[model samples]
Target: MQLFYTPDITDSPIYYLSEEESKHCIRVLRLELADHVQLIDGRGGLYEAEIVDAHPKKVALKLLTRELEYAKRNHYLHIAVAPTKNIERLEWFLEKATEIGIDEITLINCQRSERKEAKAERLNKIITAAIKQSLKAYHPKLNDITPLQKLIAQPFDGQKFIAHCEPGDKQDLSKTLKPNSRYLILIGPEGDFTPKEIEDALQNGFEPITLGNSRLRTETAALEACFEINFLNR
Candidate 1:
């Protein structure tokens, strides 16, 4: 079953289907009257509906059921990383990360970060596709590109980590993760985090984490951290 994300769920027995979705439904899928479909709002509301009528520009559905999803686990995974200089790599991370299940992502600007300005609109589209492709109802929240210094100050009530390749006492990301615990992992630029930046993170209560012994690209490190968090939860 194909499910589309719709943030707004109405109870008046009406929904304004987007033109593109309407066209896909009526022309591409050719769904007939009373055909069933699912609509999800990234905020955990899933609506089960049956088609009332199929119009080229307006396909209507009658809400059959609405399910409010509970949190699968107690913890949340938030990955903040510098966007790769190559836009494709950044986009690749976004797609796979969403597929693998991430709670939130922040594009951070670090001293060595090659790419400073990241577009949120394009990333939003990629995330939406990943959510549909992976058959997930929840869409991870995406933050505007922010300075690494500014992002560090954000409230993180649970475990916080900074993934770096520098030699020092650093914990393995997977080993340090706690099941059902909220986590925030910060990844640095291609050149890695500056000494002062690392010091600042530690001072702010972010523990040092190592993805593995091998050196990975900015996007790779971020994706690896994401997978580790999900794996620990599983």
Candidate 2:
């Protein structure tokens, strides 16, 4: 079933579809009046519907029922990382991570970070598609790019960890996590975070942790941490 997105469906028929979606339903799908379909609002709600009007310029639907779906994962994952120099790869990471499941995201600015800026608009679009594609209720929170020191100073309630490459850090992400807990993992850039950066994080009570054996890229490391925290369900 093709998924249609509408934020408000309040038991209404003849709901207006977006411009692109209108074309797909009426022109591409050739869905007729009374044809059944599904709709999600990019939030927690899902609506089952039937096409009430199928004008090529405007496709409308009537809601039959609505339900909510929740993720099975025991923990919430927030993968924080420095923005990549290769922006496309970073975009891919955002898309895939959302599809796989993540609670929140933060783009950090470490001392060695090649890029300090993250385009909130572009990332928002990527996240929107991921939520729809993955059939998820909540969209992951995308934080603005921030300094590493400042981020550490903020009060984070859950298990806080910093995934720096500097040697001698002990805890493993997989082993350290507790089921159903909220987790935040900080990953650094290509050149890697400086020693002082790691020291600051450690002093701020952020645990030094490792994702796995093989070295991974900045985005890969962030995503790997995401997978690790989410592994309880998988």
Candidate 3:
């Protein structure tokens, strides 16, 4: 099933594909008039559409059917990690996390963070592609880059955890997670979170957790936490 991302599909029965998406459908995929295509609004709506005009630059489609989908997981999973110095690694984490199932993501700047910024546009594109590849109807939200202190200060309704390499009273992430409950996990940069940063998180009601014994890279730890949470919920 070829799924296209069309987040702005309103109540109108007809819709025009974007130029990039049009080229892919008409030119690359060679979808002809009357051919059926699938669309996802990234807002829990899946639509079955038929190609009305096979214009390479502006392919049009008529909606045939619509279905609303709920998230596979009962709860929300939010992972905030310090951006990796090598952006490709961060991109890889985003792709896998989206495929596995994630509700939200935030890039946090820690004291030891090497890269303080993330390309929102490019990262969002990666997320879109991942959703299409994984056939997910809902799009995970990508939050702007935030500082460690500011992020910890925000109010969260569910369990909050900080996964770090610090040797303290830390619980196993998989065991600590509660099924069907909202979760927010923090993964630090390559150099890891500073002592003061960990203390601050602890004071702000964030529990310290460990992924495992072996020290992992920033992206690896982030992805591991993402998987662990989803796995436990399953």
Candidate 4:
């Protein structure tokens, strides 16, 4: 089944595809009138639609059915990680995390961060593609770049963890994770979080957790945490 990302879909009986989506459907895919297709609003809404007009610029569709909260997961995961120096690595992480069922992501700036900024537009595009490719109805939110301290100060009801290489008492992330619960995990940069940063996180009720025995890169460690959380929940 070919699933299209339509974030603006509503409860109306008739809906129109965007210019980009229209072009792909009518021109690229060669879909014609009466052709059936599936659409996801990226907010847990799935629609089965039939093409009424195969216009190349604005394909009109008649919604046959709509399902809300389709295939919703039992757990919510939010990963706030320091973006890698290489933009490509961070992009790869976002793509895989979206495919693996992450609920939210934040690019955090740390004291030891090599790259302090990121292209939010490009990264968001990658996430949207991954959601459609994975046939996911829920879209993962990509938060703007945030300061490490600022995020730590925010309110979170779920378990909070900071994964750092600092040599102190830390719990294994896989073992510490509580299944079917909301989670927020922090991943440091390649150079790792500073001693003061680690201390600040601990003081703020964030537990120190280690991914594994072998040290991993910033992106790798973040992905590992993502996969571990999903695996445990599975």
Candidate 5:
């Protein structure tokens, strides 16, 4: 089934695709009038619709069916990781994490972070594309670049962990994780989190956990954490 993203889709029977989506539907995909297509609101709403007008600029659709909480996961994952030196690597993490099932993401700036900033608009686009490609109903929340200490101070109801290579007693992330729960994990930058930052996180209620013995890059470690959480729930 061809899936299209319509984040603004409402309960109205008649819905019009955005100009960009319309062009893709009518011109690129060559889906003509009466073609059946699927639309996702990125809020757990899946819609089945028939094309009413095949105009490339504003293809119209008649909504036939709607399903809420379609394929919704039983768990919630929120990762706050330091942005990689290469923006592309961070973008790669975002795309893969979305496909792997993540509930939220925050590009954090650590003391040793090489890349302190990110293009939210571009990253969000990548996530949206991944959601459509993966045929997911929910969209992960992408937060603006935040400071490490700031995120560490926030209150989280479920598990809270900090994955770093610092010398200290830590638990294995895979074994430490619990299923069907909300989680917030912190992943350090290329240089890893500083001792003080690690201390700060621990002091702020974030438990120290190790992804594994083999050291991984910033983006790889983040994706590994995402996969671990989703796998545990599965």
Candidate 6:
């Protein structure tokens, strides 16, 4: 089923697709007047719409039905990771994490981080595309890039964990995470977290966790953490 995104669906039953989306619906999809299409508001609302006007530049639709679907996981998964040096790798992680299941994501600038900033707009687009592609109703939240120290200072009600390579008695992530509970897991950069950074996180009540025996890249480790949380809930 082809799903189109339109976050702003006012109370009115009639809605017009954006210029870009209109072109795709009319020109690419060859949808004609009265053709039924699915629309997602990205806020858990899936609407069934019928094309009223088939204009390629400005297609209009009338809502026929609306269904509210909640997230698949009972608990929320929030992953904070330092952006990788290769921006593409970070983008890849964002896309995959959204497809797998993630509630929120925060990009952090660590002492050893290579990339300090990310395009929030671009990342949101990637997330939107991923949600549509994966047939997910809820849209994941993408937070702005923030400093590691600043992020840990904020209060979180859920369980907190930081995945690092520093040698110590760290529990396995899969075993450490509790099912049906909110989680915020931290994944470090390519160089991993510094001893001082690790200490700071621990002081903030973030437990140290291990991903696995094999060392993974920054993006890979972040995606692994995301997958682990979803897997446990499943």
> Per-residue alpha-carbon lDDT of model 6 for 36-143, expressed as tens digits?
998888788888899999889888999999888745569888899999889899899999998999989999999999998888999899999998998787899989
Better of 2 and 4 by TM-score: 4
How many residue pairs clash in model 1?
A: 0
- Clashing residue pairs found in predicted model 1: none
Error of 3 at 131 (Å): 0.5
TM-score of predicted structure 6:
0.96
Off by over 4 Å in 2: 8-14
Pitting candidate 2 against candidate 3, the one with the higher lDDT is: 3
Candidate 3, residues 206-225, lDDT tens digits: the string is 99998889999999999999
**Residue-wise C-alpha lDDT for candidate 5, range 20-103, written one tens digit per residue:** 999989888989889999999999999999999989999999999999999999999999988888888998999999999999
lDDT: which is higher, 1 or 5? 5
Our model 6 lands, by Cα RMSD against the true structure, at 1.2
Which runs in model 6 stand beyond 4 Å of their true positions? none
Each candidate's clash count: 0, 1, 0, 0, 0, 0
Tens digit of per-residue lDDT, candidate 1, span 84-139? 99999999999999998898999998999899897899999999989878766688
Question: Model 5: runs farther than 4 Å from truth?
Answer: none
Residue 75 lDDT in model 3? 84
- Tell me how far the alpha carbon of residue 119 in candidate 4 is from the true structure, in angstroms, after superposition: 1.4
Roughly what TM-score does model 4 have, to 2 decimal places?
0.97
Please state the error at residue 85 of candidate 4 in Å.
0.9
